[model samples]
Target: MAGKFEISRRSNGEFQFNLKAGNGQVILTSEGYSARSSCENGIESVRRNSADDARFQRKTSSNGKHYFTLTATNGQVIGSSEMYADASGRDNGIRSVQDNAPAAAITDLTAA
Candidate 1:
């Protein structure tokens, strides 16, 4: 099945990209991005790729649930959230978190 992509700006004023597969079933997401290009890059990469990835700034456990966090290069906590399980959950949650941020600008498809 073909996948879908969504882009937005986060509450913390960062860029984010979301990917959905299986006809609207979200499959992967990216953390709060510091730049618009980065977010779009992430989204496009997900569209062309098949792997699932979660880039967390910190790993912690709280309230009987595991929490994942994403930080900007400047040390700001742009995105912080929790996940129920392992990689899959974390990856989806990451995208869920991305929903609040602005969509990164799309890049050149031919660029290397």
Candidate 2:
């Protein structure tokens, strides 16, 4: 099965999206946007930026968990991964995003 993007409204009424891998694991999550259109644009940005390794910023939290953020050409973050136990897992998550995002189908849960 191919990966997919799931868009939904937040409890706060904003919009956000998650990129799920073929096995149904969420590889990346986007920040909340005031408008659904902005959230959709963020998904497109991820599709475009995921192709570039440089667009992925790998980082470690102060407690030492590994994670990564995907950024657009202007340097704004498009999405981020959940904290991983190790760098290897974080790297795998990045690879998953790269492999899956470009052609991922969008499932808009926001629609009634």
Identify the candidate with maximal TM-score: 2
lDDT of each: 0.51, 0.97
lDDT of 1 by residue, 8-111 (tens): 67789776755544355543446877887776666554433222233345364655555565544444343345455665675566555344233323323223
Cα lDDT over the full model 1: 0.51
lDDT tens readout by residue for model 2, 1-112: 9999999999999999999999999999999999999999999999999999999999999999999999999999999999999999999999999999999999999899
lDDT of 1 at 88: 60
Worst ten in a row by lDDT for model 2: 36-45
Q: In model 1, what lDDT does residue 52 have?
A: 24
- Measured with C-alpha atoms, the lDDT of residue 49 in candidate 1 is 28
Give TM-scores for every candidate, taking all chains together and pairing residue i with residue i.
0.42, 0.98
The collision pairs in model 2 are: none
